[model samples]
Target: EVAVLANQTTFFGESGGQQGDAGVIKTENGAIIEITDTQKKLGALHVHLGKVTEGDVKVGDAAEFRVDHARRSSLRANHSATHLLHAVLRKHLGDHVTQKGSLVAADRLRFDISHPKAVTAEEAAVIEADVNSLIRENSEVTTRLMTPDEAIELGAMALFGEKYGDEVRVVSMGEPVANEHAYSLELCGGTHVKRTGDIGMFKIVSEGAVSSGVRRIEALTGADAANYMSARENVLATVAADLKAVPEDVPARVKALQEERRRLEREVSDLRKKLATAGSGATSGGDAFKEVNGVKLALRSLDGIPAKELKGMVDELREQMGSGIVALVSGDGGKASIVVGLTEDLKDKYSAVDLVRIGVEKLGGKGGGGRPDMAQGGGSDPSQADAALAAIEAHIAG
Candidate 1:
């Protein structure tokens, strides 16, 4: 292990929220060991974890290792973008914002900052825009080693509880000729892009409160950000085409649909009440009334009436009929709705739930249960509605 640690390597180990470099090591004898991860421990010791995929590797063997450059570039871009995002948050949300923690990965970045309140969507958009603007400026990212006091004097932000030696590495991104204090300056030891422009693009994918007074923002940089935007645009286009409207007019079209739906709902409700009144007039005396086993019953099948209106219809029937078992079946298409209501007097003799169950069973459906005074159920076969009502009537007679 010490021999592997002692080997002179150009690969950078994991530090400051950035991932370690990954690659493979080849021995002089053509043996290969895959280096999955590299981490720094005990000051400057680079611990490498790997498996020997080829021949045996002994102590003190000479080996050549290659770092994954593409992966490293991605890490560098995301890491640098975190710094810019931090600066932007502090700028837009006021200096009360401070870095809490972060995770800088090759594919995405997460930044945790201390803020009193949750970030709003508008604020997140502004912060993202500011970060992207900084990337467009292509500010020079510079790193320097100085005393902790000197770094602090330059307004370099330091992490809480982090032990810093006399010499600290300070990372700063800015065009000093414009404003030295304008960019992000922090004490960090992670790898980063050489210039802000290297990030290519910046986007905040999501933001939320991670803890009390701490908010987290997850984002993508470079091609990842561009790809996310492209995919979102494609989804919007598909939705617009489905609605037969252009993307710019989609919101208005959706709003119009909602209004139309509400208007139709009111109209349907009015028509149901009118129809119920007309049916009551036609059968008010004795047309739909019958006597089964000495119990008065009123049975009727109505068409195109919604299940939601069945309860109201049952209520109206209970009020007018005074005493009886009212079984009403109404439906359209292939669906059927059955509602059974018993007057106050008949509720003790028979259960409304039992009546509804009889109807639903004859119609070959499930999910039927309710109270004694009123119960409702639905079935898929509307054509069987007549048989369902007949079954209920037979049950009452028997």
Candidate 2:
């Protein structure tokens, strides 16, 4: 479909982490149609789409076409730069690599590639330098069209599970090399520059692995790169001034600052430990052997009882409770905790794990436990704590 001022064209843009391109088109009437947005879609036909706007015009009308010259140029540089970077990555990291996604802006391009390990700063610098070197070498950007069978025969690499028609678009960088020194060549439909040099001042600012085997890279070229560097330098200058240090001395200064910070953290941790000790009291060792269902039961309360400490106390207190039933309750920081212990002699209907599970549930919370001898669980519902205790006391008796 078409209109007087603008025509609808599918453009693939920064959706799904892939950055869209900025371009413009024009009508024959000299009315400029700016292609301000591009998008890629997950659909049947026309994977890439573009939107253009101008004076009101109906569809089914013919309109002239033009892409935003400056924006398109910059985007092409970055997009083409991605190809160069892709080639460099394969050269260094081998052919197991594949493009996960990409974002191309006026001056910067971010590429996500599949790899197992995090890309180090040195590796990113190398990749950037390599791409820039190729650009400086001025590789010709050549385009070729071939049938699917012909592309396969010519040893062109293609994406996995991608649907292709009888004809495909191929973009090549530089002259083809023999076995190894090849520059860059891939099948692509996105717009690109005519030459690698058009992507002035390629650089890789950062790189990191996204997942177990996928990596991400952000790079800049031309003015975007220049601005980033300048901003970084300004930050360094400000920090240096604050520290009364030189530019190169900032790292050492920052390291010393970090050490000071760690020392303060340790001091705070020690103070917290001391405060906890002062407030926490050890569990009491007094009463036990409450009779339930003609079986001796175990119960106790102690201060400063950690979850593990409570478990230990409960284990020791169990023997005294005998084969009847054992239940332990302790409070920590105003929160209620409990553990259940049963004897092997009466393990048939009574289970420590099941007991604890029920205890936590009836208490309006959740809990879990272990074997027939003992299990542990706790809940945050302090109001239901007493009811929970009474329920467990009767549960073991039953």
lDDT of 2 by residue, 1-398 (tens): 23122235534444423356555555455444555555545432222233445654444446654445777777788888888888889888878888887777766789988888877767777777778788888878987899877766666666665778779877788556686424676767667888778877876688786777889888888778778888999999999999999999999999999999999967765554333223232221233355667767655433334566556555555654456666666566766677777777878877888877776776566757688878877777655655666677777667
List residue ranges in candidate 2 displaced over 4 A.
Answer: 1-34, 38-62, 105-107, 175-181, 205-212, 264-398
Q: What lDDT is obtained when candidate 1 is compared to the true structure?
A: 0.84
lDDT of 1 by residue, 198-296 (tens): 999999999888889998899999999999999999999998999999999999999999999999998988888656544442223436466789987
lDDT, residue 66, candidate 2: 48
TM-score of candidate 2 on Cα atoms, chains taken together: 0.59
Query: TM-score of each candidate?
Result: 0.72, 0.59
For all candidates in order, the CA lDDT equals: 0.84, 0.68
Candidate 1: where is the Cα deviation over 4 Å? 1-4, 40-45, 176-182, 262-398
RMSD of each: 5.3, 7.4
Ten-residue segment with the worst summed lDDT in candidate 2? 276-285
Q: Candidate 1's error at 313, in angstroms?
A: 5.2
Best by lDDT: 1
